[model samples]
Target: MVYRHLNEKDRFYIEQRLSEGDSLRSIARALGFSPSTISREIKRHTPIDFKGLYCHRLTSRCAQEKRANAKQGQAFRQISEEAKMLIHQRLSTHTSDQATLFRTNKLQ
Candidate 1:
């Protein structure tokens, strides 16, 4: 099954509802998402100290870092402007192969 992700606004709303002492089920009903989703978000993103204050920027950055770190020990691929320019130059000169160009190079 495909999962639909919540937006930044929804995340902030969840934090707000959590801060306002609303039950997880109530917030889930209001947002039309499963209670498990709410529970997971809260558990994953909550501050270690459990302070009531919520910072959207911090939460978003933390989530991004978490995603990035999950792919550790993978092969590294360079994607700098210099590399792109070289590829473009090859394509312009008809020296690059289409199969190689379409290959998925995972970035570290």
Candidate 2:
């Protein structure tokens, strides 16, 4: 099975079904998702002040903010232009590929 993130439409559907007094299991079945998935989504996005109410618009915005924040610390940040120029200069002057590779790996 492939994993997929739910979109705004799915959130709207959930909100609609919830407002209609549908059971979580029924909503899950209708949406072709597990009941626990639906349950968790509601729990994750529902504000404490909302008193169990689920708002799709607010939930979507909250999810977007979380995703944006998560992208701050990526595994490999881009090298600056000056650093790239220095690397190019060093590599161009190096005679042995193996020695250059070893030095680069050591520096990292």
Deviation in Å, model 1, residue 43 alpha carbon: 1.2
lDDT of 1 at 59: 73
Report residue 4 deviation for candidate 1 (angstroms): 2.2
lDDT comparing candidate 1 with the true structure: 0.72
Q: What TM-scores do the predictions have?
A: 0.55, 0.67
lDDT of 1 by residue, 25-89 (tens): 99899988999987877777768786745555667777878888988854335465555665677
TM-score of 2: 0.67
**Which residues of candidate 2, in runs, are more than 4 Å off?**
74-104
**What lDDT score belongs to each candidate, Candidate 1 first?**
0.72, 0.83
Task: Encode model 2's per-residue lDDT on 39-75: one tens digit a residue.
Answer: 9999988899999999999999888888888888674
Steric collisions counted per model: 0, 0
